[model samples]
Target chain A: MSSATTTAPESGHGHHHHNPEDRLALLKQIWMFSTDHKVIGIQFLVTTLLMLMVGGALALGVRWQLAFPWENMPFFGLLFPTEGGQISPEAYTMLFTMHATVMIFLVIIPVLAGAFGNFLIPLMIGADDMAFPILNALSYWFMWPAIFCFGASFFFGGGPGNGWTSYPVLSAVPEAAPGSGFAQFFWLMGVTLVGVSSMMGSVNYMTTIINMRAPGMTLFRMPLTIWGMFITAILQAFALPVLTAAGFMLVSDRMLGTCFFIPSGMVINNADPTVGGGQPLLWQHLFWFYSHPAVYIMLLPAMGMVSDMLACCCRKPIFGYKPMVYSMAAIAGLGFIVWGHHMFTSGMNPALGMTFMISTVMIALPSAVKVFNWIGTIWGGRPEFNTVFLNCVAFVSMFIVGGLSGIFMAAVPVDIYIHDTYFIVAHFHYVLFGATLFGVFGAVHFWFPKMFGRRMDETLGKWHFFLTFIGFNGTFFPMHLLGVAGMPRRYADPYLHPYLENLLPMNQFMTICACLMGFAQFILLFNFAYSLFKGQKAGMNPWLANGLEWVAPSPPGHGNFAAVPTVYRGPYEYSAPERDDDHWLQTEPPKSSPVPEPPKPEPTPDSAPVGEDTGSSS
Target chain B: MSEISHDTGSHAHDDTHHYVNYFLIFIALCICTGISVLFDVFKGGIPKSALVFGVMAVAVAKALFVMTYFMHLKFEGAWKFIILAPTAILAVGLMIALAPDMAMHYYTNDAPQVKWVGGEHAEEVAETEHSEHSEHQHEHGGH
Candidate 1:
């Protein structure tokens, strides 16, 4: 990781190295440290996957309990026995809480926002790498302390059980619960670290996307993955900081006797505490203000990847390409106004609830447009429903199912009834598992060839998708019914409601589905590892995607394209008659456009062939 | 392709162009923080959020001067603005969102355990207290 810099001097041949590589020393240097964006992206991806497995295993333990409540189980019950009884109420709460936190902050967000976002941004835009390489390394490292703190809570005391939302009355007072003190601290620190990592990553991505696009690669003539990452980064820049402040405020209230989130005269265990006059709702306002947008920050990049992959695999210009881009911006802009949807049942003002409801309903429109655009994208094209394409298509299907459930909750009256119930559970799983992780699977399969220069076993991948998809829906879809039947979420036992007798069977069924879903991840793991060593070699453009990354060598070198690409047309120019192939890379010139697009070559790359900028496309 | 460095940049000190505003700011903040700490520890009075934010305002002003002149964010690129615009939006958004919650703590009159807020409700309550017993009158005297 050293380079020679030629310097002009009286001694004409003299040059110096900023970091001179001496063979053995250089190997150690490269092994110990390097600030390459690709290296950092790979590091983030690997870290995210490791945490995913750990989190997933914890989830399996949880599912085991629900499937066979208070019974001796294979792995989890034995490991987490509470004095030879069942898993304790506190432990069960902590496990569920940490599982969600780890999966969201540690896995899905990092895998997309930090990993693929970093790995793809420079390559797609034809830059060597990210704008600030050293800061990139620091951001990844900063994530570790936060993770370590959260992990350490298991040993020091109870883990955070306030749910990933960390609603204040549950999270504020250290003495509020058995786990609140140390567990909540660890959770806050972990979340805050993630915020720092995301902000740094956002700054790097936005700057690179803006300042480092190759010659002739304008804004509109870029892949949707870049557009997704760009918007996600912009959203992160706006969202993560508010959450950071929220975490800091929570910590201040806990440790320093600041009454920022506690109101006077509240009784915890029939005892009044010293802290007073802070409102708990303040915490919710702050937390959700960041977290609601954080949902898009979590999911949008995957959507971008799926759109790009689906277009390429189908050999069609993406249907309503302009709508896809504008819809994303609309989603982000609308995201800020809708955080109150989460708090409608938390005793929010009825008027504000309606406003938030309308915004929440409005949020669904952009996504529905995306869903329509996705269906239309695959329709009327020479289709190739490969495992990658299936996963891509599945992302839309799952998102629709998940997204439609969101509309039910967005209606203020329905939300009041189902706010903290299993219906909410079904709604989000349809989102995180159905949509976000569905996109993640597509991304992993679609990019494995580019990332490793080897194709994943298609059959194994299909098996993985089928089992995960069915298991996911089977597990979550019933929750909507359970929630409507008054099955409260985050409960250790359904017996909390004596009258809800019939739901036990449904709960058991969902738990079984959840366990089976967890089991299928191993198929993916096997496919990933086996393919790394034993898979077929994927030459560049195996799927024949019309993006710049494919034109570069497979397992692209550090500099990506051998020649810096000059982008020439919209990313979705496909199936045109003038082109020999069905696709056109954005980096290719319209004048050099082999495909016959009927519209005249106006050469305006920033806008749609016929559309306006600076306004919503609708 | 060119290789990246394996070490932290050593030329950081060689440049020797330390920011004047940053230096002056560091000195000024150090003195102010010293005085504030002394006042709090000796005088037995601590600053509120408003005062702390005021101090932070001064520090932020100083830091911005340093970043523009020293860190060179001022001349960096349009992308830096692109990066920063959203951060500004989020900070303002959080304050806007948090304001109602803070206001609600004082405004929600139905909650009896909490004290009466200094508003029309408090005025109404004060009138009632004056009409009631001497103890209620004492409670309403300063409140």
Candidate 2:
């Protein structure tokens, strides 16, 4: 194990002298089935973005019908040319259901946990690659069949229409809903494939994080981003199997004559009921059990990435690093028990509701701790106002709103009213979109150079961020008012009831804003594309960050580091009085020795700097 | 750093003693399966719920044997339990939350029309079905 800090740049370039024939074969390997973590990360990024576009298109269709009831859609209506281009109630149901499914399962989880998690975990922890490279590759490739199956669901009697939860009775009996038959089967198949992929990825992540860190890179010395990926992988490993089993039972109920969820003596579409001796509430119990932890699964990596970027740009150590780590762990631990919060309105025992409500409210303590720690990281420091920093700050601000709004729902009495309203919709988007997407954007901006060896234009990036911020607020913030006005969700037409008639103007406003926000994302796509070739070339340590990733090449090669780096201190070491530069690199050997020596002695607490002795610095 | 290069692979070892132990565990698992079958064969005298509980206990024991021996969890460090703890706790917690629904019957009769996803017309359908279901329950006793 040679030190990467001593590796020469010329040695890496010397490998380029291979013959053209060999080069072509190498290119094929790199593009097609390479097990390199960076390549897989890019693959996850591209695939999940495409899924996001598909899901976004569905959302636009949903918004269109809600804004202008019975009105003809322009470009998208051509896809479904029934009822003179107007979105049918049936189509609208499929749109929203698939939207939630694609976004939750396909887009957010893969992008945050799959793409960035794969790319950053090894690099930050000073590992060469994932512990199981083949499994890492399989994780990304598995999504292809899943994406295909999800798309195929549309052709087979329309897509799943009982919402993403696919509640039984509606999902069990094909006669109950239009898409309940074969389409729902495809939905289950697609979800099961995704679950398998995620579980495999989780195992790989856990093994790599625990067993593959560089010599001195202890668990506490690793970056918060690594911690984030570690906990998220654990969450995925445990939670995804339950979802897989639920999906299997669903398939059994629909295809086989097994009565797992359908109760006896029930009529479907005004016909004789066949299934017997099963509970519909059982499906809710299983789905939410997996889904509650899934909420943390989506956001934890983002929070971790945001923590890293925030510490880097602020030019200071992350405030309360141990607290940050513990809070995230606390969130993951509490996440599993609080699933019943989603079921308060769901006719489970009302006594259990009190238990879940207490657990759910207690989760806010850790959430608040994370928020205060982020603010503390930025306090009294000359923070860089780059696009990444702006996005991280926005994530914190919006996450505050998201967390505070969650309290309203955490209280059982308040939740009983807003359970299925647009307010619930508003609350989640603020967390998912406002908080998580902002973190995703920040991370893309922060790590774009490392991933692509070039910088995204800061001007375009900042413009994209501001427009998205404003558009996002305008789109979702009004939903709180609409919810308070008693507007029910999942309705294709908000004009169905006389009470909702007054909310039409606000609904139309949100749709327009949502369209603007949707269109503004193209700016990011353009920035990403154009910056790939045209932007300024980035150096190895362009940001002058403290992580071990800075010791590697800009876009690291087959093996991330020439030699796995030996860490001397924690990832974030900023404003140390002994260093000339404001930030200190983790890979840098300690300078206390009178003479610089080869094969430096491993850094122990006795000889390290003041901050290094803390043992928990990130 | 050189010493730690292959630390991840250190857990893999070929020990004959462990293999013999695994074989012994496998035999124990087989014996448990046979006893569970015997309980089922003589089901006339034993209580039905006790028989169910007995079978479930045997199944749990079998799963533990497989996980410990075949899965190599017995040789692994404390981190093995760290992984299993949350999954087991949450599973029990979910069952706890669901206990009321499973034990106590909530609704007097199954209202077939009152589907969660059946929307507005389903509610009206439920109104008609409610009256009919109550009469049916009066005649046949609730299912």
Candidate 3:
């Protein structure tokens, strides 16, 4: 702590008040199309947070309906219809469908991979900017049209009623669902645009990571966070195109009179259908082909960030760093082969089911290895019970439940009962909400000072974490029981079933917990907003963390580094026996050697107006 | 050959490449398409499977030519093959996995009934297995 305090002065070239012209131009550049990765990252953060709020509101509505199945005479319920605020079946279908879509596509993916990945990669790798700045901006810009399409779908007639998977036959025909008309078209187009945006971001991420690493920052020298993001980017690059193609085929089915996914059904509403000779299962196959990898796409970045934060907070090197990296790689590689697991009950061949079950079970091995390594990393180390550390620990514990529960679904026998049940809902929420969402909370807290140049209130942050952890468990854990009791998911009314009658009290309880959880998130939102300006000023290396990102000033300038930094060691050099401080800087000179001053830049024929690289001799 | 240098600070690399050979490959692809069409035209006497195999071979050849030359994969280094090989293998593997489903129609016996529009005619669910089992066959024959 003393060493960090002593060194803080050197790094405190904090933000100074700029002239009016400079301030106006900076504001304009930030709000408009700025190519800086940091600004782009902020844009993604703000946009995705807003999307999260919208998705959360939809989830509340869903819970509201479930809590009081038919008694929906409320302020918000009036938006659906005049029938005493009771949610119509059509609107209820739209509620959960749009909720899943917005959360997965708009919030999680963008906030985790798009925002943090963009912001941290250049800083972590000691690069100035992404390989293609214009392309990066285009990736962010592409999301807008996708968002607009999603909003426009509601007004076109209704929003898409099909689940996020949007399986065909039901999703294909306008006659099948109320919103399956022009609205479905808008939904398809929105997804396609998002796919394109993700593709652009992935390409930029891959190229920049591969090509723009600073001198001495070899592949192995990279932080686990970068590796996580890198592998996630790779998954996105390959997997998203499959989804795009699926979306295209679906669009053709809807608009171009094609029967790619529509099966040869003789009757709909007791009337002979015009479309025929397509396979509905084809949609499931293609959708899951990308979607299964998409699960890793959401999880990997969080895993990576958690690894880094754990290493930092524990004041130790991450245990089995190589194994951790390999496990993620293995996870990504096995992700492709396990897509068939999602299709086991879709009238797929039993032999194919056996093959898929084996692969799906095998994929869990690497994830388990990662969990073991995280525990090993934290085993003997002194830990700071900061909000970041608390959330990260929650991620590990909750992810174990998420991972172990997946085994039940991966086994064909068990999945038969739990396929569309609340059990599956609980399984995914543990991973998505418990693991990834918690990771998001942790990473934001850990990096907020570097991001906004202010510290978030520690007391407030801890309260947010505890309430969220308790509320999340309270809401979702009972779902496993409900599922075991044979409660089916996506049904507007479970009261219709005699078997589901007793589950009403439990549902009511869960809904109350869910509302509490949703409200608890506002503490985070408030903490984030208030701390951005009014919180205590954060100096560089406030966490005393060992990474190149901490070497840069808090909220780094346009090009990030004052001079191109040469990395001398791996990111986690914490608690080295010889070092007096808990962490060692990657760029620091050895004790035997005096600090070398920057060499004068020699004029070159191809010299641009940009500052010359200052070579620091180690 | 256009040899443009992409000066991206510390990671400046040359992205410029020759284009004249790409045009030649395009011409070759055109010839291959013609050959494929010729196979289809003269296949009246040939076995249908053999004709399909011949056409597929020509398409593969044309695709390789385009990927290697027109797509500039030849000059793009080893990573191009590394990235592309797995994608090709997985795609083909998925197709193979789907072969049984493509070749067989399972709903000839008892099939899931389509939900009717407007929620009318929805109360046969009690004996749905027995009744729809016999009725679906008629629709299968009609298709």
Give the candidate number with the greatest DockQ.
2
Candidate 2 regions exceeding 4 Å error are A1-3, A6-31, A594-618, B1-31, B41-75, B109-143
**Any runs in candidate 1 off by more than 4 Å, and if so which?**
A1-32, A589-618, B1-93, B104-143
Chain B TM-scores across candidates: 0.43, 0.61, 0.58
- Fill in the DockQ of model 2: 0.13
lDDT of 3 by residue, A511-606 (tens): 989888988889999998887766667777778887888877767778888777766679888999997788887666456655533423432322
Model 2 in CAPRI terms: which quality? Answer: incorrect
Cα lDDT tens digits for candidate 1, A384-435: 7688888888889889888999998999888888889989988888898888
What's the lDDT for all of these models?
0.75, 0.82, 0.81
**Which DockQ values do the candidates obtain, in the order shown?**
0.12, 0.13, 0.09
Error of 1 at A459 (Å): 1.2
Model 3 residue A439 CA deviation in Å:
0.0
- Judged by whole-model lDDT over C-alpha atoms, candidate 1 comes out at 0.75
Off by over 4 Å in 3: A1-30, A270-272, A589-618, B1-34, B45-48, B69-76, B105-143
Weakest 10 consecutive residues of candidate 1 chain A by summed lDDT: A3-12
